[model samples]
Target: MPATVIVNARWINEARQTAGGLRLENGRIATWVNDRMGWNGEQLAGMPKGPRLESDR
Candidate 1:
């Protein structure tokens, strides 16, 4: 499976971990990306790209 970059992902908690993106690989989370836009506002590592997605809490 190819790695996926989930942008516009916000983790609201005491830790305040603003996980810009999540790198998913092999059916699991591979790593955390600090850049929400996915590497200089563009896709990197050959991950499929998509528009920013957000949800109300």
Candidate 2:
């Protein structure tokens, strides 16, 4: 089974937005956003696969 890791990772989504939440996978960070606004399961599911970066910068 794939281990779902909840990391304080930073990312920018395709729409060019930012958000934060429990990261669930390890791959290429296709897109991401800030965590100011929360996300739902469906939204999280739509998030592009991305690799966890050591830092936001």
The 10-residue segment of model 1 with minimum total lDDT is: 10-19
Error in Å for residue 17 of model 1: 24
Native-vs-model 2 lDDT? 0.37
Per-residue alpha-carbon lDDT of model 1 for 1-57, expressed as tens digits? 123323233223211222223343322332333233334312434434333344212
- lDDT per model vs. reference: 0.30, 0.37
Model 2 alpha-carbon miss at residue 29, Å:
23
Residue 45 in candidate 1, Cα distance off native in Å: 2.2
Model 1 scores what on Cα lDDT? 0.30
What C-alpha lDDT, on a 0 to 100 scale, does residue 56 get in candidate 1? Answer: 17
Give the TM-score of each candidate: 0.15, 0.22
Model 1 residue pairs with clashes: none
Clash totals, every prediction = 0, 17
**Quick one: best lDDT, which candidate?**
2
